[model samples]
Target chain A: MAKKKTSLYREFVKGLWDDNPVLRMLLGLCPALAVTNSAINGLAMGMATTFVLLSSSIIISLLRKVIPHQVRIAGYIVIIATFVTVADKFLAAFLPEISKSLGPYVPLIVVNCLILGRQEAFSSKNNVGRSILDALGMGTGFIFVLVVLGGIREILGSATLFNLQILGDWFNPWMIMILPPGAFLTLGILIGLGNWLNERKVKV
Target chain B: MSLLLLFLSAAIVNNFVLTYFLGICPFVGVSKRVSSAVSMGMAVMFVMTITAAVTWLIYHLLLVPFKIEILEYVSFILVIASLVQLVEMFIKKMSKPLYDTLGIYLPLITTNCAILGLALFSVLREYSFIESLVFGIGAGAGFTLALVLMAGIREELELSNVPKPFKGAGITMIVAGSLALAFMGFAGLI
Candidate 1:
């Protein structure tokens, strides 16, 4: 029982940092860079992704034995796509504004490597309980990064955070920070900082 | 003239990699060498064109007619996966040299969002079948253009002194940011 608990803890903990789907693993860069122009958009995209990841992991884990080895990738994708569809429809139905802002990206979650990667790597091997923990951890990590990226861009680019003015009038917004270049530049620097911080901690 | 604009817009003004952020996995992974980048880009272009055609047909003929459009994601993804497998086999048998160049990247193309994005974007734009085909070719051309350019720059970057933390994907991302900025110049051209 002790060993099982520890393993579960490890599975969850690893995704939070050591194997973060974005900052480290770089599994889902498309969405990480695409939808993070503002804090709310980032949060919405992250939550939607989390919903898909969480549910899909559970389903795939439960069906691991039943899915044939040769077609497991296809099986996992269909499962992920179903949850993505549900998330997409839910967002469109309830959160039309954010849904419109997110655009095709909501449906594009069907292709996000992060969800499929988890099913193929973790969920297929682990039990439902452990897989749930793993998905939540990874989803949280993705959310943290997206929010940070969005916050930084929104603040500098538009002088707002979560739609509230955060900077003074004297501080002119950096228009480039909210554009495509900004997404690439912010993620690039964040990743570098992550590596630098990791190295410093390791040296200690 | 409209077709020309569509092709140009898809190829440059709105590059898939730079503007939409699709296919970033291979963008970062396979861009270390120009030769490999060219091969990967070609493989992607080939698959993307075919996917654009197939997904359009499926969406219109089966999904739209039956009013089961919600199945778009599921069917599109499955189609891409199986198509990649079939392409891999066909190429391996047809031409040894071509397969050797693109063989490794074929499987990876299955997960490339650019493929799926191409399909989705074509549908979203409500492009006619022929227009979708043109958009596919144009987007593929744009992707290849960007990949080759980045690969060339990276090959040169090998000699440059990048900061310790920013040596790999970090530096690549910064370069891509600059590239995106440059590509923005093409805006309003078409």
Candidate 2:
């Protein structure tokens, strides 16, 4: 019983860092790259994604047995698309500004490999409790990375963090930092830094 | 002339992979070698073209007429999935060698956001049927261009002494970043 409990805990913890959906696993790169132009957008995108991920995980865990093997992928996608629609409508209705900024990206989340990958790999096999934990862990990890990435870009590009002026008036903002290339460059270096840290820990 | 502008803009000025970040999965996953990258790019282009035509028809003919645009995501995805399966089967039956070359990536196209993004963008822009077809070809060409460029760089990157941690995805991203910057030159043209 203790061993089983520990393994379940391991599953949740792994996603936090070891198998982080973005930095480590590299799933769902599109949203991670596109929406992180500003800290607020990134944070909103992350939470919305978390909501969809959590809800979908719970539902898929319950329906694991019912969905047959042949059409499982399509089944998972339908479930995901339904949640994505809900998320999209919720954002557009309640948070119009964020919705406008996120634009089609919210709907595009339907194709996010992270959520589908989790369904096929973890949620489909695990019980509801474990699947929820895994989803929360992965979602939180995804949110953390997005917030950090957003902060970096915002601070550099606009001399702000979460819409606050962190940098001094004298600080020259790098316009390119908020541009498309900046997302790729910042994420690349971050991934490299992550790899270096992991290697150091392993070596020690 | 308008179609030419659309083609140029979609293909270079605003690349799907670099500018919009639509197809980063295949961009990163299948971009190791130029040959495979070309094959993958071709496969994606073919699918994107068909997806655009079909989705446009469905959206204009069915969804708009019915007033149930809310079903856009669900219906579009289902259409894309079936289309990919159909394309896969058709290819397998028609040409074994081509099917073998595409391998798993053919099926993976169903999940590639580039195709869906193309569909969504075409709808959002209210593109006419001919314009949507042009847009699809342009987007696919852009995706292929980016992928092939990245693959070529990566092929040469094999010899260089990259830092240990930045060996794989990390370095590829930086290369892509620079390529994006270069591609930005086209932004002025359009």
Q: Stretches of candidate 1 above 4 Å error?
A: B94-105
| Residue A131, model 2: Cα distance from true site in angstroms | 1.1
lDDT of 1 by residue, B47-151 (tens): 889999999999999999999999999999999999998888887898788677665456768888999999999999999999999999999999999999999
User: Candidate 2 lDDT, tens digit per residue, B1-190?
Assistant: 9999999999999999999999898889889889889978987898889888999999999999999899999999998998889888988999788788778777778889898899999999999999999999999999999999999999999999999999998998899899989988778896
- Candidate 2 deviant stretches above 4 angstroms: B93-103
The RMSD (Cα, Å) of candidate 1 is 1.4
Where does candidate 2 chain A have its weakest 10-residue lDDT segment?
Answer: A7-16
Q: Going through the candidates in order, what is the number of backbone clashes in each?
A: 0, 0
How does chain B of model 1 score on TM-score? 0.94
**Model 2, A28-115: lDDT tens per residue?**
8999999999999999999999999999999999999999998988998999999999999999999999999998899999999889
Mark the 10 consecutive residues where model 1 chain A has the least summed lDDT: A7-16
